[model samples]
Target: MAVNQESLLKKYISKDQEKQTGQAPRRGPGGGPGGRNRGMNATGKPKAAKASVKRLFSYIGNDKYKLIIVLICLLASTVSSLGGSYLLRPIVNNLVAPDTSVQEKISGLLSGILLMVAIYVVGVLASYGQSRFMLKISQNALQRIREDLFNKLQRLPVSYFDTNSHGELMSRFTNDVDVIGEMMNTTIVQVFSGVISLIGTLALMLYTNVILALVVIISVPLFAKAGGAIANRSRKLYKSQQAALGGVNGYIEETVTGQKVVKVFNHEDISIEEFQVLSDHLQKSQMNAQFFGGIMGPVMGNMSQISYAVTAMIGGILCVLGKFDIGGLTIFTNYSRQFSRPINEISMQMNVIFSALAGAERVFDVMDQEPEAADGENAVKDGVMDGQVTLSDVTFSYVPGKVILNHISCYAKPGQKIAFVGSTGAGKTTITNLINRFYDIDSGQILIGGRDIRDYSRSFLRQNVAMVLQDTHLFTGTVMENIRYGRMDATDEEVKEAAKLASAHTFIKRLKYGYDTMLEGAGANLSQGQRQLINIARAAVSKAPILILDEATSSVDTRTERHIERGMDRLMKERTTFVIAHRLSTVRNANCIMVLEHGEIIERGTHEELLAMKGRYYNLYTGKAELD
Candidate 1:
C-alpha cells in the first residue's frame, strides 16, 4: 500500500508534541554577546524538499567552470576503475590458461599486472584533482552565500531584528553553513562517483551474463526501500537536532550577556538548571539523528551481500551445466559486487543530503524575507535638509489595531531646541523615530523642510539626523575609531574636537592609552557614564543638522550631567534639536517644552509658561504626579 505523506507528517507532528511536553523546550549552547533569540520554533514549518534541492543547485552553478572540471575528473576516475575490473577477465582467461607455456604465461601475466597498476594510478590522480577542484568551488559558493546573507541583513528593516534573536541568526552562519560545507566536501563527490560506477557496472555485468545481471537488478528496490525509511526518520531527527542546538546557543548568549543581572538576582543555580534542560534536549536529539543515519550503511551492506549471494548461486548452476566458463563466472561475480556497492553508497548518503537541503531551506527562508521599503523614484537626491521638522496628524502603532500615537502634530523650527516631557510610553521617543524614518508612520505627513520625509532617500535622511540613544553600544575598537564611526571620513583633529564638545576628552585623556585604547564587548571595561559620553561624542562628530538626545544623559550623575549639560548647550547652539528626558532640569533651557499625556500633547510652551499654566506639566514639574 502507498503511504499518505500528509498523514505521516501529521502523525510525526503529534508525536513531536508529546515529546516536547515530556521534556523542556530546547535552549542553544554557548555564550557571547547580548542579543534576542531569533531561532524558529522546534516544530516550525518544514520546507518543500524538491524546491529546496533545486535552489541549492543554483548555488552550485555559480562556479560552472570548476564544476565542469570536477565532473570530468570524476568521470575519468570512475571509468578507469571500472575498466581495470574488466581487465581482470582477460588476465584470468588467457594469461593463466592451462594450455599456455610457462615462459609465455609469465610474460603475459607480468604485462597485464603492469597495465592494471597504470590504470589504478590514473584513477588515483583523477580522484585527487576532482577533490581539490571541488574544494575551491564549494568554498567560493559558501562565501557568496555568506555575503548575500549579511548584505540581506543590512537591507532588512529594524522590525525584522526586533522579532528575531541574534543567536538564532548567528547559527545560520555557523551550524547550517557548516553542514552544507561538509556535504559538498564528501557526500556530493561520493554520490557522483557512486552513480557513474553503478551504471558502468550494470552494462559490463549484462555483457558478461544477462541472467545474473537480472538477479542483481531485482535487489535494487529492496535496498532503496530500506534506505528511504532510515532517511525519512533521520531527516526529522536532524531538524529537531538543529532546532535544539539553536535553542541552546540562544540561551547561552542571553545568559552570558546578562550574567551580571543573574548574579545580582542570585539566580545562578536556577540558570544552570535551565541550561541543563536545554543541553539534555540537544543531546537526545543528536543521538537519535545519528543513530538513524548510522544504520543505513549496515543495512545496505547486508542487502548487497544478499544480492551477491543470489548471483553467485545462479552463476554456479550455469557453470555446472557447462553453459558458462569459470573465468566469465568470476568476472560476473565481481560485477555484481560493484553494481550493488554504488546502490549501497547512494542509500547511505540520503540522510546527509536531506539534512543539507533542510539547512539550505532555512537559510533561503531568511533571504526571501521582504526587504525594507525602497525609496520612490523622485526621492531627494541632492541631500539638502534644512532641519525644520513638522508632523501633521501622524498616527502609528507597533502593532495594528493597537494605536500608540494618535493624530499627533508637532513642529521643530530650524535652529531651535524642542523638548518633550512625558510619562513612559507617552510617545516621546516614537516621535524622534518617525523623524529619522527608522519606521514609517501608519497614517501621517511627517515633513522635513516642508517636503514629506518619505520623499527623501532613507540613507540620506538618516545621515542628516543624528541620534544619541539612552542605551549606548560600542564595538570592539579604539576610542578614536569608535568616534570616527559617526563620520568615517572625519579627521583626527575633528574627532578630538567632537570629544571635547561632548566633554569626553577629559575622561578619555585619563585612560592608560588615551584615544588609542581598545574596547571589547561594547566597552565592558568602561563605566556606563563613559560609554554614554563616547556615544554623544560620536553623534557630535556627525554634525548632522538635526540632533535627537533620547535620555542621553540618563546614566551620568547629577554633577556629571551638569558638566555635560554645559557642553550640550554649546553643541545645541545652532542645531535644531529634540530632547526627551524625565529629568525636568535637563529641558529647562529649551526654547519650547511639550507635555504629553497618553499619545496627545496636553501642554505646549516654555518651562515658565507651562509652570504658569498649573496643568499636567505643572503637576509633573512639582512632583505632584511623577513622570511615569
Candidate 2:
C-alpha cells in the first residue's frame, strides 16, 4: 500500500498560531527566554511535507553518484533474496520426483542447498555495500545542511535576532537538524528498500500461482485500512508529545539559567511546581504516542499471519486437487510471507519519516526569512569618515503606528562630546541606535562626513562606529584575545595599550596570568566591574572615529567609575562621542547635552545653561524630580 506522506503530515501539522494572534507568543514566567515557542510553536505543526522532502533531497543530491551506487546495491540485495526463494520450486520438484533415483535425489538436495547459501551470501554482501555507501551520502548531506543554516543566520537582520530567542535559533542546529540526520541515515534507505522488496515479492507471488496472489492482494486493503487508522491517531499523539517535550526542555533551560534569581526570591517551590506540571504533560503525551507507535508492528504482523494461514490452506486444497504442485505451493507460501514483511516495515517507519519532514520544515522556515537589505548600488564601499554626525527631523518606530522617535534633529562636529540624558524609554538609546543605522529612520536624513548615512554601505558605515553598551559579553577565551576581538589584527602591545586606556591594565597585571588569563561563561571568573572594564578596553581598541557609550560605566562602583571616567576622557579627546547616562554628573562636561522626553529633545545646552533654564534637565539635575 502506498503511503500518502503529504496527506498524513497535513493531519498533524498546522499553521503557527502567531499568524492569527497579533502579539508575540508568550514566553515563560518572568519573561524569561524559554518556552515551547522558542524554536517552534508547541501547538503548531510543520506545513508542506512534500516541499520539505524535495528540499532535503536537493541536499542529498550533492552526492548523486554515491546515492546511485547505494540504489544499485539495494536492488541487487532485493533481487538476490527473491531469486533465492524462487529456486525453492525447482529444488523441491527435483527432490520429490516419483521417477528419480535415491542417489540423484541426494545429489539434487545437496547442490540446491549449496546454491541457496551462495545466493543468500550475495544478498548479505549487497546489503552491507548499501549501508556503507549510504552512511557517506547521509553525512555529506548533513554537513551541507549545517553550513547553509549557519551562513543564513549570519545574513539575517538584527531585528530577527531581537524577535527570536537565541535558544530557539540554536535548536535548529541541534534538535531539528539532528532529527533530519536520523531520517537521512536510516528511514530513507529503509523505505526505499522496503518498497522495492514489496514490488519484487508481489511479482514473484503472481508468477508462482495466480490464486495465491489474489489472496494476498485481497488482504492489501485490510493492511492499508488498519495502517491508516493507526497512523491517524499516532500522528496527533506524536505531535502533542513533541510539543510537550519542547515545553519541558524550555522550562528546564530557563530554570537552570535563572537558578540564582530563583534562590534569591525564594521561588524554588513554585519552580518545582511549574516543572512538575510540564513534566506530567510530557509523560502523558509520550505514553500515548509510544502506545500507538508500538502497536503498529504487532497489528501488522497479526494480519500478515492471518493472510498467510488462509493462503496456505487454499494452496493445500489446490495441491490435493492436482491444480497446483507441492513445489509451487511451497514457493508461493514463502513469497506470501515476504510480501507482507515490506508493508509492515514501511508502516513502522512512517512515524520517523513524518518527524524528519517536520524538522526539515522548521529548518527551512529559518532559511526562508529575508536577510538584511542589500547594499545600495552607489553606496560608498571605502573611505575615511570624519567625526561629524547629523540627524535632521528623524522619525522612527520599532513597530508601525507606535513612534518612538519623532521629528528629532541633532548634530555633533569633530571631537565634540554630545550627551543624552532622559528617563528610560525616552529615546536616549534610540538616537544612538539610529546614528549607526541599527534601525533606519522612518523619515529624515542622517549624515556622517557631509553625506547621507544611507549613501555608505552598512559594513563601511559600521566600521567607523564603536559602541560600549551597558551589557558586557565575553567569549570563552583569554583576556587578551577578548580585547583583540575589537580589532582582529591588533598586536599584543596595542591590546595592552587599549587596556591601559580603559584603566583595565592594572587589574590584568594582578590576575594570575595577566593578559593571558582565561575567562569563560561570559567572564564569570571576573567581577562585574572587571567585565565592564574589559568591554571598555575592547571598544578602545576599535579606534573608530565615532564612539558611543550607553551606560558604559553603569556596572562599576564609584571608585572604579572614577578610574574609567579618567581613561574615557583620554579616549574621547580625538573622537566624536555620544553618551547616554542616567547619572546627571556623567554628562556635566559635555559639549552639548540633549534632554529627551517622549521621543523628543525637550532641552539642549551645557550643564549650567540647562540649570539656568530650570526646566526638565534642571529638575533632574537638582534631584527635585526623579529620572525614572
Candidate 3:
C-alpha cells in the first residue's frame, strides 16, 4: 500500500519551512535555579524563565505510567531526605543536652538514631531503584531519538551529507546522548538532593533560633548571585569546549577514514598540525571553565564558614549573658555550616547543567532541521504508477542556481528502456533523483503515468522505482536478511529465487552457513563482486516496474561484470529500465542511448545510428575501448 503524496507532505516539514539559524527554542532550566517551579512558568509573571522548567517535562512528552512513576519516586526520595533532617534535631536536643534523665535521654537518643537509620536505608534503596528506572526511561528515549535521527539521515538529500561531516553527525548520537543520560542520572539526583537538603535545613534552622537563621538567609542571596554570575561566564567556555571536541573528533574521523589518501598525498604533517589547534583549544576551554567555575564551591563554603564562626562567637557571648543555651548555640552554628552544603552543591552542579545544556542545544539543532524533499499537500495519491514518464522543460540543481540539468526533457513508455551515458557529473544521477523527487525540480514539470509526479505520493513513486546503485550498502545481518531487505515480507524461497535470477545463489550456497550466514557490519566480510551480486539479488526481489541501474557493474572485475551483464539482460527484458554507466560497451544494445554532456542531452539514438553519425558516443566508445 503506497502512501499518498499529500500525506507525505502533511507529515514532512519542507526544507523551506526551517527555523532561522541562531535563535533556538527555549526548553526548561530545571533542578536548580527553579526547583519550586518544577513545571512551566506559564503565567505572565516576572519570572517567565521559571515557567519553562515545567515545559521541559511537557517537551519530554506525557505518558500514563513512565513519568507518573518517576514523579512518584522523586517525591518519595525528597520526603525521605527531609525526614532524615528531623532526626538531627533529636540528636542535638537529647544526647547533647544537660539536665536529661538517663531513661528519657536513652529513649530519645535511640529513637533519633533509629529514625536516621530508617530514612538512610530507605533513601539508599530508593536511589538505587530510581537510578535503574531512569536508565530504562533514558534508554527508551535515546533509542527513539537515535532511530528518528537515522531515519532523517536516510531521507535527507545526498547534498546534505556532502556538506556535513560524518563525525559531527555521529557526535549527535554518541556525545549528545551521553550528555543527556548523565544529566538525567546524576544532575537530576543532585538537584533533588540539594533542594531537599536546603528546604529541610532552612526549616530546622528557623526552628532552632530565628535570629541566627536570618543571618544564614541573608547569605542565600550571596550564593545565588555568585552562581548566576559564574554560570553566565562558564556557559560560553563550556560551549566552546564542546565545539572544540566536535572539531577534533571530526578531524580524527576524516583523517583516519581517509588515511590511505593522506599517505598517498603525503599530508600527515599538515593534518597533525591542524588537529593540534583544535586539541589545544579543547584543553584551554576545559581548563578555563573548570578553573573559573570550579573556584565557586570553595568561595561559597568560605562565606558559610565565616558566617558560622561569627554566629558561634555571638551566641557564646549571649549564652554567658543568659540569653540562649549552649546546646541551642551549637545547633545554630551546625545549621549555618549545613546551609553551605546545598548552596555549594548548587554552585558546583552548574557546570554539569551547562555541559548538558550545550549538548542539548546541539541535539536540538539537528532535531529541528528541515527535511530535504517533502511533498505538497493534496499532491498525488498512491498507485502502481502504471503510466509513462514525461519530463518537460525541467531544470534542477543540487545547489541552487547552478543547474545540473538545464531545460532537459524526455519521455519513456512503460516498457521502454532508457540508457544514460556521458562524462561524470553530467547530471545522470541527478536526473534519476528527480524521478523519485529526491530533489524537486527547480523548474518544469514531470508527469508520471500522465499525471504530475509531484501529485503522486513520494512513497508510491519510490515503491515502483528500484535502483541498484553502484555503491550498494548492506545492513549488519545474515546473508538471507541482506537479500530480504529488498522486500521484507519476502519468504526464504522467494529470496532464493531472486538470488538465482541475479546469478548470486551459486556462491551463497557455498558459504559456511549458506543463507543464514551472518554478515559483518556493512557486509565488509563479503568480496566486492559478492556484495554487488547480493545487491542485484535485492533489486530482483523488489520486482519494481521502473528499474534504475546506475553503473551497477563498473566497480567489479571483467568476469564479474560479464556475469552481471548477462543477469541484468535477463532481468531488464520487457521491464522499463534506466541504465546509467560509464562503460559504453554495456549499453550498446540499449533500446535508446541518451548521451548527456554538461547536463543537456547531446545525442539520442540507437548505438548503430549514433556510431553512424560518429558523435560523442561514437568517439567515447572508440576512444576508451580496450584497443587491443
Candidate 4:
C-alpha cells in the first residue's frame, strides 16, 4: 500500500484544530486526489532499488577522479592488511623450528616483527587517504542532489505544494539526504573493503589447508540465510519507522506554527493528546526496527564463533597427525577467524544499506514527478499584456467528475474593475486563479490580450500580474526590503511611496528602526492588520497592469479599509483589477459586479443596478439573506 505522507500529517493537525476551534481544515487546492505512494513493495523493500542506486551513482560519477583515488586507497589498505597477516605463518615457523638457536630465533623474530610493522604503517596511511577522498566525493554528490531537488521544487506547479505537506518535503532535504550522505562516507568503503578481504582470506586459507578451507566454506549458507531473514524483517520495520518519523515532525511543525490558535481555543490538552499518539507510534516503530537491525551483528558473530571452533579442532588434529606443521596450523586457524570477520562486518552493514536505499527512493520519487507543463513553442516572451481577459465556455475541476466551475464565461476589458461576490465555495477566488493561470481550465478558451493564454510563457504571463492574498507572508528582511520584493529593482523612494499608498508609511515610521527594522518568522512582530497593509504595499509596488485582490481588505478595520480604498483608487486607475470580497459595500463602485452561484454567474451588473434588480445581490446587501 502507498503511504500518503501529507494526509498522515494533516490528520493529527486538522483533527485537533477542528475539534477545538470550530474551523475546518484547509484542503488542498482544487480538492484534488491524494499524494502518490512512497514507492515501497509489499515486502517493504524499495520498489526500484536498482534504478535508485543507478541514479544516485550518476550524481557521484561527476567526481570520477576523486572516486578513483578512493578506490586505489581501498585496494592498498586491504592488500597491506592481508599481506601482514600472511607473514605471521613464516614468522612463527622461523621462531619455533627445533633446529633454530636461541640467538637466531630472536633475530628472526625481530626482523619479521619489523616487516609487519612497516606493512601496517602503509595500511594506516592508505586508510587515512581513503577517508579523506571519500568524504570529499560524498559531499560533492550531496550538494548536487540537494541543488537538483530544490530546483525541481521551484518548477513544480502550485497544486503540488497544496497536496504535499511542507514538513514532509523538508524531510527529503534533511533526514533523507543526510542518511544517503552517511552511507556514501562510511558504508560504501567498508563493503568494498570487506568483500576484497573476504576473497583474499579464503584464498590464503585454502593454500594453507584445503580441508580447513572447505570447513569454512560450508558455513557460508548459514550466514546468508540468517542475514537475509533478519534484513527482510528489519527493512519493512525501518520503512515504517521513517514514515512515522515524518508524521511526528510534520505535526510538531504545524502545532508550533499554530500555537496561538491552540491557546486561544484552549485546545492545548487535546493537542498534547494528539501529539502523544503520533509520538508513541514513532517510538514503537523505532523500537521494533532497531531490535531487528541490532540482532544481525550478534547472530552473525555467534555463527562465526561456531565455525571457528570447528575449524580449530580439525586443524589441531591435523597438526598432531604430522599432516600439518605447527606454524601452518596456527596461521590456518588465524585465517579461518579472519574469513568470518568480513562476513560479520558486511552482515552488520545491512541496516545502513537499507536505510540509504529507502531514502534515495523517496528523494527520487519527487524528482520523478512531472513538472509544470512547459511553455509551447512560439509562446510570447516579450510583450506587455493589455490587461484584457476573457473566459469562454470554460469547464474546470480539481478532481475528475466533480466540476468546480461549469461552463463559466466572463469578460473584462482593459483597465476595468471587475468584482466577484458570492458565498464561500461559490468559485469567487477560483476565477482569479484561472486568470493568473495558476491552473488550466479543463475545456475552454482563456484569452489574454485577445490571444489564448497558453500562447504566453507562464513566467511571462505571471510577470504582468500581481496578487494580494487573504493570508499575508513576509520574508526575513527589513520592512523596506519586504516592500521592495514586489519589484526587485524598485528605488528606495518608490518603496516608500508604495507604502504610503497602502497607508503603511505612518506605522512603518513608528517602528523602532522605521523602514529598516528587520522582520523574521514571517513578520510575527507586525499585527495582522499591519502585515496585510504591507502585503498591499507589496502589490502596489509591482506596477503590473493586472491585479488580483482576494480578501485583501478583510483583515483591516473600517477606517483603515477606507484609507486603503482611497489609496487603491489612485493605484487602480488605468489598470485592470479583480476583487473578491465578502463585504458587499466594497464592490459598490466597481465598474461591474459578478454574482456567482454554484460556479455560474447568476447576476451581472453594477452594485446599484443589482440592488435595484432585487435578486441574490439585493438580498445579500439588505440583510434579507445570508451569503451562505
Candidate 5:
C-alpha cells in the first residue's frame, strides 16, 4: 500500500498541537490496512530470534495468555495437518488400488479419510482465527505507542525540538510503527506456519524413507549460510536507506514551510533539482535493498529444485534396494517437496522480518528519547494573581556553547505594558519563550507573582501566560472555535465578548457565515489579518494574567493597526504585558520601553525618556540613518 496516502487518510491528521494528553491511547483507526503500502536501512540485522521474541511478547504485553492460547491452537492445527497428510498414504494404497476389497477395506479407509478431511477443515478455521487475532493485537500495540510518543513530545523542551526536524519525528509515527505492526499481523504468522510445516514435513519424510530424508537435510546448511549473510548485509543497507528517507522528508518539510519564498524567488526548479539528488540517493539504496531481497526467492527455488531431484534419485535407489515401496516413495517425494516449500518461504521472509525490525528500532529510538525538561512532581495549579514579572541574572542558549540570553534582567509590575524593541534574532522572542518555560534558564530565576516560575507546573505556567506571535497559527475550525481554543469549555457568548475586546467582532459578523464558518487546514482560506484577529481574540478569551504581543500589529494595515491598538489597550490595561514589536510607532504609548542588543539590555525607560536619551533607542525609533 502507499503508506503516504494512508498517512493522511484519516478524518484529518493533526500535525500541530492538538495531541490529547494523558494515558489514554490516541483515538484512531490507525496505520492503514495492509502490507501493500511500500516504503526502509541497516546492515548487521539485529538478531530477531531473541529480540523479536521479546518484542512480540512486549507487543502482546499483558495479553500474553491470549497469545499462548493462539500458539496452542496453531500447534494443534499443525499436528492435524501432519495427520491429514499421513492418512493420504493409507487412502492411496488401501482405498484406491485395484487389489483392494470393493467394500470392506474401502469402507474402513473411507472413515479414516473423512476424519482426516474434518481435521484439515478445523485447522483451516484455526489459522484464519489466529491471523485476525494477531491483527487486533498489533493494532492496539501501535495505538498505545503513538499516544505515549505524543505525550513525550509535550514534555520535551524547546531545545529538543530545535535539534530535530519535524519530519524525522513524523517518520517515527508513520513508517516505523507500520513496520512493527506488519510483522506482528503478517510476518509472525507466516513464520509460525512455515516452522510447523517444515518440521512436520521432515518428520513425515523420515517416517517414509530415512535415506531420502537425510539427503534433503544435507543442503539445508547451504540455504542457511547464504540467507544469514544476506540478512547481515541488509541490516546496514536498511539503516542507510531509512536515513536517506529522513533526509527526503526533511527537505519536503523545510521546502513546504518556506514555499512562499521558493515561489517568489522562482526557486521551484532549483528545489526540485535538489530534491532529485536526494531522491536519486534514496533510489540507489532502495534498489540495492530490493535487488538483494528480491534474489532470495529465485535462489531458494533453485536450491529446492536440486533437493527434490536428488531426493527422487535417492528414493528410486532405495526402492531398488527393497527398503521402500512405490507408495512410500511417492509420499517421501511429496514430503521432500514440502521441506523445500518451507525453506523457500524462510529465505524470502527473513529479509522482510529483518528490514521490519530495523525500522521498528528507529521508531523506538524516538520513543526512548528523554525529554529535556518536564514538570516536577508535586507541582500545583497556579493561583490567580496580579501579574508582577521579574527576571534576574537569566542565562539561556538553544545550544550549549551559544548563549542567546546572557545575564539579562528585567522587571514589569502589575498592569504595566513593557515593550521590547529590537531587530529580528536580537533575542526579543526568546525572552517571551523563556517566560512560558518553553525552555528553562541556564542560571538564575524568572519570577511571576514574586515566586520562581520553575516552581509552577509547565502547563500552569502557560495557562497564566499568553502570547500572540507574529506568524499566528490557527487550527482547522470555525472562527468561533479558533477564538475558543484558549478555553475549550468557553460558551459562545464568552467567545463573542472576547472577539469584541479584540475589535474583531464587527468584521467577523460581516462574513457570510460569520463565526460559524469552518476553516480549512491551517486557516489557509482566511486572510492574514483575519487570522491574526482570531488569534488576538483567542488570547483575550484565555484571560491569562500575563501576555506577550510579539509584533502583533505588524501584519495589519494602518487603519486596522489603529483599531487593534485600541483593542490592545483594553486587553493590556489590567495585565502585565510584554510587547515585542518591530513597529515602534504602535508601542509609543507603552508604560515603559526597553532596548535590547545582542542579548544585552542596552537602554531602558519610558518611550519618551528613551527618545530624550538620543541613544540607540532614539536612532531606532527616529529611523534617522545612524553609522554603525
Candidate 6:
C-alpha cells in the first residue's frame, strides 16, 4: 500500500512541479485553505516587488538618527580602508627611487608606516561603531514589525483564520521574520560596504590609468546581466519553496494532532507517502534555487579574474615604457582587484536579499489586511445588560449564495430556557454565534435587552454572554487558572464555588493537588467527561446574564451526563439560556423548543407539543430517523 501511494504521489508531483504550477497543491475540501492568495504569487495578482521593499523599509521609520550615525561610520570606515591601500604607492616609490637620499627615504618610509597604522586604527573603530548602531536599529525595527503584525492578527476577522492554517501564520512569526533579521543585520552591511569599496577603487583606478579602468568598466555590465537573470529565477523558486514549506508544516501538525485517528484507521502508509511528496517538492525547489543562485558568484569571479589579467599585462607594458610610474602601476593593480570584488560579493548575496524581500512582503501583506470592523459610535458602553435576546428575521450564510439561516425569528425573555434541536447543519450553533456577534446576519436584527445587538460593543456583548462549546480548549495552566480564564478578576473562592455549582468540585477533590493541578495538551491528561465538566465550570464562573451550552453533555456517559445536566439546571436559573443538544431528553423541560430543518425553523413549542405534532422532531425524538 505504501509503495502504491508513493507511485501515485510521484505521478502527481511530477506533473505538479513541471508546470511550476506557481501554486501549492490543493488542500482537502474542508481543510484550512491558503489565505495568502492576494500578494504572493499564489493569487497571480502579486504586488510590485519594489513597492513591498519600500514599505518594509518604512518599518525603520524614526530610526533615522541612528541610521545617520551608522552611515557616517560606514563612510569613515570605507575611506580609511581605501586610504591604507592608496598610501602603499608613495611608501614603496619613495624607498625604491634611486635619486632619493638615504635620510629622505628613511624619513618617508617611517612617516608612511605611521599613517598606514593610523588609517587602519580609524577603520577598525568606525567599523565597530557601525556594527553597534546597526544591531540596535535592526533589532528595534524588527521588534516594531513583529508587534504590528501580532496586533493586526488580533484585530483580523474570524474569516481570516478560517482560510489560513496555524502553521502558515506561525511561519511569518518564525521563518519569515528571522529571514528579515538576517537581511538587516548582515546582508545590508555587506552590500553597503561592498558597493562603497567597489566605487572608490574604480575611481582610483581611473585616476591612475584610464585605459585599464575602461577594461574593468566594460566587463561590469556582463556581470549585471547575469546577476539579474539569476535573481529572477531565484525569486520565483524561493517564493514557491517558502509556500511549500508552510504546506509541509501544516500537514505535519495536522497529522500529529490527529495521530490517534490515523493509527485507528490504518492510514500510516498514505500519510507517509503524502509527507514524502511534500518533502520531495521542497527539496526540488531548494535545489533549483540554490543551483541558479550559486552559479552567479563563480561566473562573476571568473569575469573579474579575466579583467585582472588583462589590466596586469597592460599596466606592466605602460610602466616599462615610462608612460606610467611604478607607484601608479602598483595602485592600479590593487584597484583592479578591488573593482570586481563587490560585484562578486553582491552576486553571491542576491539570493538572501530576494528571500528577505519576499518574506517581508508576506508579513506586510498580513499587516495590510482589513481588520475586523469596529462598532458604531452609538454602541453601548455602559456594560449593563439584561438577559433578553431576540432574533428578528435573521438570515446568514457562511458562503455566499448558500444560505445557512433563513429568516429565522425567535425570542427569549429574561430567565427563560430556550432549546434548539435540529439535525446537523441546521444552523443551531450558528444561532449562538450570531447572538455573540461572531458573525453579523445578512438581513435581520439581533437584539439583547430590547436593543440591537449591534448597538452593543462586541466586547460588552461577549462579556454578557458565555458559551461552552462541544470541544473544550484548556490552556497549559493549573485547574484554578483555567477556570479563572472565564472571569479574570474572580477570586479563588468564587472559582471553587462555580466549580461546585457545576458538579466538578467532587472530581477536583479527588485529583492530586486539587485546584492547583496543572493541565496540558488541552487537558488531555483528564478524561473526556472531566474536561467537559471543567468547561461547564468555566462558564459557571463567567457570571454572565446569557449562556450558551452547545452539546455540552453529549460526550460523557449517562451518569456524568446526569451530573452535568443537573449542574446546567442550576446554571440556567435567572438567566436567558440557549441550549443545543443532540440528546432529546436534555431539552424535555425547556420553556420552549425550536426544531429546524434546511435552514428554517419548522416546529416550535415544548417537547410534549412537538411529540403531539408527530413532525420531524417527533421522528428524531422517537429514534425513527437519525440526525444528519
Q: Please, what is the whole-model Cα lDDT of each candidate in the order they appear?
A: 0.79, 0.81, 0.70, 0.82, 0.74, 0.80
2 against 5, candidate with superior lDDT:
2
Query: Which window of ten consecutive residues has the lowest lDDT sum in model 6?
Result: 14-23
Order of candidate numbers by TM-score, starting with the best: 4, 6, 1, 2, 5, 3
Best of the two (2, 4) by lDDT: 4
The lowest-lDDT stretch of 10 consecutive residues in candidate 3 is 28-37
Assess every candidate by TM-score.
0.91, 0.90, 0.82, 0.92, 0.87, 0.92
Candidate with better TM-score, 1 vs 6: 6
Ranking by lDDT: 4, 2, 6, 1, 5, 3
Stretches > 4 Å off in candidate 6:
2-47, 626-628
Candidate 6: tens digits of C-alpha lDDT, residues 493-578: 99998888777898999989899999988898998878888888899899899999998877767776777667767876788889
> Model 1 reaches what TM-score against the true structure?
0.91
**How far does residue 90 in candidate 5 sit from its true spot (Å)?**
2.9
lDDT of 1 by residue, 231-324 (tens): 7677777777766666667677778899999999988987786766667767888888778877888889998898899889999999899888
Per-residue error at 222 for model 3, in Å?
1.8
The 10-residue segment with the lowest total lDDT in model 4: 16-25
Residue-wise C-alpha lDDT for candidate 4, range 1-628, written one tens digit per residue: 3344456545633321112111112243555433333323333544466677789889988999998998889888988998898888888999879998999989988999899999999999999999999889889999999999999889877666665667767877887888788888888888878888888888888888999899999999989999989988887777666666666777778788999999999888877877777787779878888788888989999999999999999989988898987788887888888888887887777677767776776677677656788999999988788888888989877655668888888888877889999888898877878887878889989998899989999988888788997678999999999999999999999999999999999999999999999999999999998999999999999988888889998878888888888888888787888888998878788889999988989999999899999999999889787634
Clashing pairs in 4: none
Give one digit per residue, the lDDT tens place, for model 2 in 225-272: 999788777766665565455555555666777889999998898778
lDDT of 5 by residue, 112-159 (tens): 778988999988988777777767777777777677678877766564
Top TM-score model: 4
Candidate 3 per-residue C-alpha lDDT over 1-628 given as tens digits, one digit per residue, 9 for 90 to 100: 3334343221121111222222122211221111111232112121322332343334444334765566566657666766675556567767767799889888888888888889878877776776666666656665666666677667666545544557766776787667666666666656766776677778877887787778778877877887777777776666556555665667678887788799998888766766665566668878987776787787878877887887788778878887876667766676677678778877777667666665555555565556654677876656467637788999986554556798888888866778899887788987888887766888999887788887777777777778887678888889899998888889999899888877789889999999999988578788877888888788888867778888776766776667776766677665677889888877887888999989999999999999998878888889843333
On a 0 to 1 TM-score scale, where does candidate 4 land against the true structure?
Answer: 0.92
Where does model 2 exceed 4 Å of error? 1-47, 626-628
